[model samples]
Target: MNVRTHILRRNNTGGIFHQRGVAALLLVLLVGISATVVTLGTMSYVRGSQKSQLTVHGQTQAEINAWSGAEALGQYLNGIEVETVTTAMDDIVFSRDNQTIASAQYKPDCSQTSRDLYCFDVNGISAGHNSNLEVVYQIPIIRDVSYTEISNPIVIKGDTEVTGGGMAYLSSDSIDGFAVDGNLTITNATKSIASGCATGNIHVNGGGVEDNGHLYSSNGDITLEGLNLVGADIWGGNINVLAGSGFHFKSIKAVKNLKVTNAGNFKSDFIHANAVSFALEGQLGETLVHSDIAFGNGKSHLDYLEAGGNLIFHQDDQSHVPEFTRNSKIAGKILLRTGEDGNTLSTHYNSTFKNIEQGRTATDPGVPEWPECNVDATPFDVNTLISQANYIFYIDESDKPMLKIQNVKRASDDKSIDATINLSSEGGMNTAYLHNKPFFQCEWDSKSCITSKSNSTDGWVFEGVTHFPPGVILFAGKGNPNQRNLAPMNFTLASKSEKVGPLLNTILVTGDITLGRGGGRKEIHAPYFSSPDAVCDGDFYPANLCDKSSGSWQFEGKWDGDRVERNYPVANTSIMVNHTMTSEGWSLEGSVIVGDTFKTDSNLTNVHGVVVIGLNSDEGGMKITQGGIVVDFMDLDSNFLNIPTGNTQVTDESTLGIPTAMWARYY
Candidate 1:
């Protein structure tokens, strides 16, 4: 019985041990499984974090690339010529690591906001990331003049003196300032003057100065008396404002003394001078006076004042009476220093001062520099135009004195042709006639015309037989007499057309161009002699018939003679003369460029276009005698002629693609 019981106990113990071992094994397997799951989860998390970081880097890179492309395009536009900027605004690609990373293109129709503004759009790509950027910039107007360094585009090499009630009206655009190398004095009562820049003194007595532009004097004084000076900045050596003048200026800077007396209704933004003496009634802005200040009897309003010397308030006779009632007010600070004899700031009755500061060292206000004049003798070469000409005619001693052009074939292949020909003259009656057909028989002395083909052979003819091709006409006189050729002959163009048509012709003469002097009245209607359509007409030269009753030749009761007219709206007519261009009782339309003098005498003359005088000599300028001359530039277009590449003057306001505004987005 004991042996059987012991065997049962052994079997039970073995079974319990087997069960414990199996349980331990199962616990080990569970621990292993949990560790494996944790490892896999950690790996997955790491991978995901790396991917997110790479995406962010790519997005940032794309944005940077887009910004860089925009900048690059701006730089390119800044370096290239302004005329080519529009063409360069096409699609432009940027590459990195031998791959195209970004592209830039111009945004069209954006100029409607402002003609000076330009817009650009850019796109960048990096590692499947895209970015877009838009940039905007502003540009300024570009002006082309004869000299790049000259501040004034219209230059008279010598003095311009108009005296004795002569009516001389000079005007120009703001960009094209007028200049005289020598003195400029206008003593007429009916003068309407614009802005002027001079190397010498500028004196004006009795006239109206327009609010056109600024006046700059390099080394001389500027004096104004008995006139109305309006809205102009005067910078010069000295400025003198006398009695009976109405003054309104933005700023006045004088190197020497600035004297003002009886300046009625005076106003200025800023005034700087070495010595200032004012006895005026007006408002003044910031003023910097280097020397002593003499403020006389006047009611003045001042903004800021800085005086290097003694500031005194006295009467017109320089007597400092305490009872002198001078009401003056200051809005800002007053800076002053003690002058001779320990004399400092002095105030009159009813005078007000603000933030007065004394016992300070005075500062020197430097002088303003003068503008340079570097004009070229010839801005363009006449010989260079030869290759571009379609018809070349050389008139020398062999050609007839009276050359007639009739029934010539018009060039139909091209829009325009350039004619380089010479017109001959002899016996003081030498005339050149360019006519299309027989249209009118006009009497010069009577200023009357009869539209009859029977009498057309005797007088100027204007039948519609043919038309002169539209082109640039050049008239070159014989070479210089002292050199080898004969004396320069005057270019006289007499045109008789039945019907005046749309004319597009630029006439360039090497010598003199005379009108309204001979027995017959001269007329020029170009692009052709005459046409039946009658598209153009002038003062004396009518479109269909030369009827004096219908057209009044008298202009301002002064001019009554021949007429050179281009009725076309476009600026297709121009006249350039190397020497004198004289017009008597004549009216013209187009640009006039004279190398020497432009003269008008005993008649009224009206000109529409740019007038550039004194291109060859410093002795002669403009001479107008007993007549009125009016030149209006606003009637002509700016692109009438091509500006030379070397003579272009760009203003400070123009900058190439400055990138004023920018916007960016990423996808």
Candidate 2:
């Protein structure tokens, strides 16, 4: 029984040992499964991190490529030859290693208030990622001198009559034309009128007319009496060729009638007239007459004559016969309107008629409509100048000091006055005067009060004087226009000293401006005026003064005193006058816009720049009585004029575009 108990105890212990072994095995399997799950989780996290890093790098590369594309577009725009962005453009690509990294396109947005603004869109692709960037830019607008009415050398709103002994030569290198709103009469003087348009009659009496251009008398006749007309195409209502007149014309078109009486050497390439009458002797080339034609008395030569009505050959004397060349063709019926002898008519028909057909067709070149006048005389009121003026001066006869000066603050950071005006009195004549004592310094030796400052912060300086750095001087006369007793503001610049008078730029005068004394020694010297940013030291004028290789700024003025020889460059200064501008033998430079007549009595030595006449009034024109003036028109740069703000259109082909503003953004 003891042995049996021992065996059961042993079996029990063995069973307990087996159960512990099973628990150990189960613990080992649990550890292995936990390790496998942790390893799999770690592997998945590592793969996800690597994929996220690649995606971030691709996006960064795409953004960089977009910026690069924007830069490339900017470079392309800078390299293009066109001045302004006219239309939407595309197809600009940035590529490397034969792979396109980005593409850019230019899109113009003209609907905005700023007209010249544009935008560029850049799309970048790198490593399967894409990005977009938009860049905005603004372009500056540059105006040209051709857009202004001052481009013409002469603009006259009223009658222009050259009636002196000396010749009046009108020519321009830029436009070679003149505009006259009224009658253009050149009598007793030799005048060379360029391509011109006259609203009234054009009468050339005893003067020579040589223009290699067209002349149109829009509403009246063209009378050439005792003159030589050469190289001109004339269009008028009636062309009357009086006695002893010679014509070498390209073409002549008369709407009403063309009469030639005892005219010598009438030659034209083509002639069209409603009714033509030739008496005495004349020569005519290819002519088309809409109505009747009468050839009387003298031997006449006609080539290719086409008449809509009858072609009459009248013989007052039996000996005189109207002869024509074999090239002559008559499209109308030949009739002896006022000849008693039928035998003379038969002889003339046999000698003159080459081809006479009643039903032959003739092309009528219709009369050209009158050319529009290029004179844009928009009245520039003095009040407008006053509103924009930095300094205003009023001259009154009643005040103790005749001159009153007023300074206006145009900007917050305005600089001190850096300009001067010289006033001098010579031989009881008050030549120059400016009121302010601080701005005027007297030179005791020359008896002249020189107005000048020591330094200037802005504007251009010439011969120790600053002009229009950012200032404009206005001279107003406190006088009534209707009352002759109360004198209007008349500023006469008569210099008896060696130095010039007040050299002012961009001046507005409400009164008349008399340049120089009659037969006096006063001379004016001015340099080429430009903007403050202009580099005047190149091939241009004021720069050419320092260049010894270039000749002196040609001054052909005959100064009366010790000839003050200085560089007189072509000035771009503006002188606006409300009344007549009388030049009494003075040498003047710069542009002058006159509201009244530009009258010259003595010899005008040298007159440079453009002269706009009859701006405010239609009663006055250019009247040169004695002196022979030469107006050398210089094209002023666009920077001198006021540029209006807004969306700028590409109006001129010579415009220059500059990128003013730029911004970029990523999308």
Best by lDDT: 2
Scored by lDDT, model 1 comes in at 0.46
Please give the CA lDDT of all the candidate structures. 0.46, 0.48
Query: Model 1, 1-667: lDDT tens per residue?
Result: 0000000111212231122111211111111111110111101111110001001112256755665565455445542335455555578887766767678877766552234566677786678887876655543222222321333335565676655334333444444446677777767646645566777898878664567456677778889888776677888888988876577888888888889888788788888888787774457777777766566555566666666665555432322321212332222223222346423653333333334343356444544455443333344323223211222222345543222121122222211111112232222321223232222123322122212321212222222222333334444443321122323344544332334432445455555665543322223433222331232232112111111233542211111122222122112235566667776655555545666777765566655544566666667576654454565555333443222212223333222322222222232
Error of 2 at 128 (Å): 51
lDDT of 2 by residue, 1-667 (tens): 0000000101212231122111211111111111110111100111110001000011256765665555455434532334334543656777866778788776654223144456777788788888876666543333222224332455677777777533333443435456677888767764544466677888877655455677777788888787667777888888888876567778888988889877777777778888888776557677888777777766666667667776677654444545555444444566664435533542234444444544345734334454454555566445433323334444234421122222221122221121212221222312122222123222322222223211112111112221222224555554321121222355544433343342434455676776655333444433333332221221111111112233432322112232212111112334667778776665555556677777777765345545666767878787766664555543433222221111122342422232322344455
Summed over model 1, clashes come to 7
Report the lDDT of model 1 for residue 400. 30
Off by over 4 Å in 2: 1-151, 165-174, 316-331, 337-352, 359-368, 386-392, 396-415, 418-445, 448-473, 479-488, 496-507, 518-574, 634-667
Clashing residue pairs for model 1? 437-463, 438-463, 439-462, 462-497, 462-498, 558-604, 559-604
